[model samples]
Target: MRLEEIARRLGLEAAVAGKGMAAEVTGGYCSDLLSDVMANAKEGYVWVTIQTHQNVVAVAGLTSVAGVVIAGGHRPDEETIARAGHEGVTILLTPMSGFEVAGRVHALLSQTS
Candidate 1:
């Protein structure tokens, strides 16, 4: 599914709609640790995390994730938002926990597959 589709499906709010990101969601991955996310996230996949740091932008860039979803209603700080915008990474916020978001994403993917 597209990034916009995934966001719509999960009722996620867009925090930073980076250039080209809303048009690029293809898959999803949920991780809390930056290292694990950087290592496991695939290009075009939406990354779900509780982390609200600037490093999330770097990891998203390195992994080429389609977007970053900040779960548990958390929002990124100004610096993180700016970096994400600069890096072309879409940042989203959802009220659900990481596990809930991941499960929803998986269910959506399963339905589509």
Candidate 2:
């Protein structure tokens, strides 16, 4: 599934979508720990996290994930948003919890698979 489709289907707000809207959603990763995501998140995966720090953008860039979903209605800081835009990292926001986001993402990917 495409990032655009996933965002639309999930009703995720494109908080900082400078680019990468067409990125593929190969899978999903849910974690609030940056190191865990850096170690395990794969390319094109949708990361579900509550972290709103700028380092989230850095890790997203490093992991090459399709997008980072700030769950539980948490919004990234201004600096983080700017960093995400500058890095072309698609930052999605949602009121759902990380568990809900992960389940929805899994269901979406499973359907496509």
Candidate 3:
């Protein structure tokens, strides 16, 4: 499923839609620790985290993630959102926990795949 489709299905709020990021999501990964996410998340995967910090944007860039999903009803700081925008990484916000978002995204991708 496409990122936009997944966002709609999960009721995720789009915080930043940088360049072609919305067209890049092929999978999903859920992790709260920045280091674990940076190390384990695959490129083109929607990264689900609750950090909501500027470093999350940097890590998203490093991992080449399709998007960053701020879970648990958290909003990223202004700097984080701006950086994500500049880096062409879509930023998403959701009221669900990281695990819930991950599960929903995974289910969607599985069904579509």
Candidate 4:
């Protein structure tokens, strides 16, 4: 599934940073720890978290995630938004919990895989 489709299917509010929703959503990773995401998230994986700091963007960029899903209706700060836009990181927003978001994304990906 593509990022656009995922957003639509899940009714997520997309707050794309740099690049548009062109990423191919491959896998799912749910974690609130920055280090865990950086270590475990793979390229094309949509990272699900509630962290709204600029460091999230740094980790997303470092790990090469397809996008970052800010669950539980959490919003990123302006600085983080600016940094993500500068770094071309995609950010998707949803009111669902991280576990729910991850499971839904996993289900969608499973269909494709």
TM-score of 2: 0.96
Candidates' C-alpha lDDT: 0.84, 0.90, 0.83, 0.86
TM-score per candidate, chains pooled:
0.89, 0.96, 0.91, 0.93
lDDT tens digits by residue: candidate 4, 1-113: 88888988999987874463778877878899998888899998889999999999999988888889999999999988888888889898999998898888888888888
lDDT (Cα, tens digit) per residue for candidate 3, span 1-113: 67887888888898997653456477878887988987899888998888988999888889888788899999899999888878777898999988888888888888877
Q: Per-residue lDDT tens digits of candidate 2, residues 1-113?
A: 89899899989999988466798788888999999999999998889999999999999999899899999999899999999988899999999999998898899889999
For candidate 1, the lDDT comes to: 0.84
Q: Pick by TM-score: which candidate is best?
A: 2
* Candidate 1 C-alpha lDDT tens digits along 1-113: 67778888778888887753555556788888998887788988889898998999999888888888999988888999998878778898998998999888888877887
Task: Please list the residue runs of candidate 4 whose C-alpha ends up more than 4 Å from where it truly belongs after superposition.
Answer: none
Evaluate candidate 4 by giving its C-alpha RMSD to the native, one decimal.
1.3
Question: Clashes in each model (backbone N, CA, C under 3 Å)?
Answer: 1, 0, 0, 0
Give, for candidate 1, the lowest lDDT window spanning 10 residues: 18-27
lDDT of 3: 0.83
lDDT of 2: 0.90
